[model samples]
Target: MKLPKKIKRYCPYCKKHTEHKISLVSTGGKRSALKHGSIERAKKRGRGRGLGNKGKWGSKPAVTKWKRKTKSTKKTNILYTCQECKKSHGQKKGKRTGKVQIENKEKKK
Candidate 1:
């Protein structure tokens, strides 16, 4: 989806509405020390003592899928940085999309 490079919105730090620069909030780089990462490694090696099921209230599956799966599409979110105060506030969740673009006049052909 395409979004304006800048937006106008209420800035709590500025005490009024102001122009804000828009940017996509990234999911960030991978962390080897992630909680699930270590737990998965342990489960694979079969020391599965403490890492129980992380899902639903219904009856547990008869056969568990070791290869966890997730939705391909992720909900897009954005950050709006107030130009005056330089403070940022997270905008409401955006549409589900694989990518988002900041519409830039300079980059437009």
Candidate 2:
């Protein structure tokens, strides 16, 4: 399905509705590297005995057939900055805090 070019989303940091730029995230170089190298090795090793499934009864899922580990194909809206605070809140999924401010009550003797 064709996706929208821009979407109005609520930014928690901004605490209000903000315009988010929507674009398909291209697969990074790291994914290509893993697909071309390590993934191939894992698939080759996983097929033989001693790795697993030597005498197992259950059938393995077809999704596991792909040698390469697939990343999220869904499109996501990433916020570049906060609209209300006018701060650069990058698209990271963790709380970011600054150093605590301290006040000197008395001078050291």
Candidate 3:
């Protein structure tokens, strides 16, 4: 779906409506190993070498997986980046589609 590159929206920080840059918010990558790597290693060592405790995930029966299906439509995350303050905001479930195509829609007379 095509969308306006710049949109007039409420800016809480600026306390007024301003033109914000339209962009797709990407799903961030996983955290680096340095931060929580040590903690996870300590946990594994304390627990046994094998899968000490298979949580709810492993407890489920894998044979029942085929019952559920994936959704046809996916909600795209639209990010509104304020040009003035340079702050970004996320719109939850903005538009549902399998694919996203960003483009400015010109005003028609």
Candidate 4:
């Protein structure tokens, strides 16, 4: 969806209204591989090696990668940076969208 690059919003730090910049917040980084209780760590410890039944870690029928189903859109967040205080804050809830664009200004209708 199209959005304005700058918006007049309430700035809690400044305790007043100010122009804020808009930007899309990207999804966070991947999880740590060495974290406890991870499948990789368990396999490295020889837990799933030479076992009759690996229980929860047991191998199952292989499925094609393309067969996996996932949501077309992702939950995205917007960051608003206050021009006065230079402080940034995100929305209370995320918006699900396939695409997001922050234009310099809204087109005249």
Local distance difference test, per candidate? Answer: 0.71, 0.44, 0.71, 0.81
lDDT of 3 by residue, 39-68 (tens): 445445553335645332343424456457
Ranking by TM-score: 4, 1, 3, 2
lDDT per residue as tens, model 2, 13-69 = 777888544443332445553464454455565643355553322244344554566
- Candidate 4 per-residue C-alpha lDDT over 68-100 given as tens digits, one digit per residue, 9 for 90 to 100: 768889888899999988999988888888899
Which candidate, 1 or 4, would have the higher lDDT against the true structure?
4
Please provide, for model 1 over 12-63, each residue's C-alpha lDDT reduced to its tens digit, 9 standing for 90 to 100. Answer: 8888989899988875565674466465465566553455653422234324
Which scores greater on TM-score, model 3 or model 4?
Answer: 4
The local lDDT score (0 to 100) that residue 75 gets in candidate 2 is 36
Q: Kindly report which residue stretches of model 4 are placed more than 4 angstroms away from their true locations once superposed.
A: 31-37, 42-62, 106-109
For model 4, name the residue pairs that clash. Answer: none
Clashing pairs in 2: none
lDDT minimum window of 10 residues, candidate 1: 54-63
If scored against the real structure, what TM-score would every candidate get? 0.58, 0.31, 0.55, 0.68
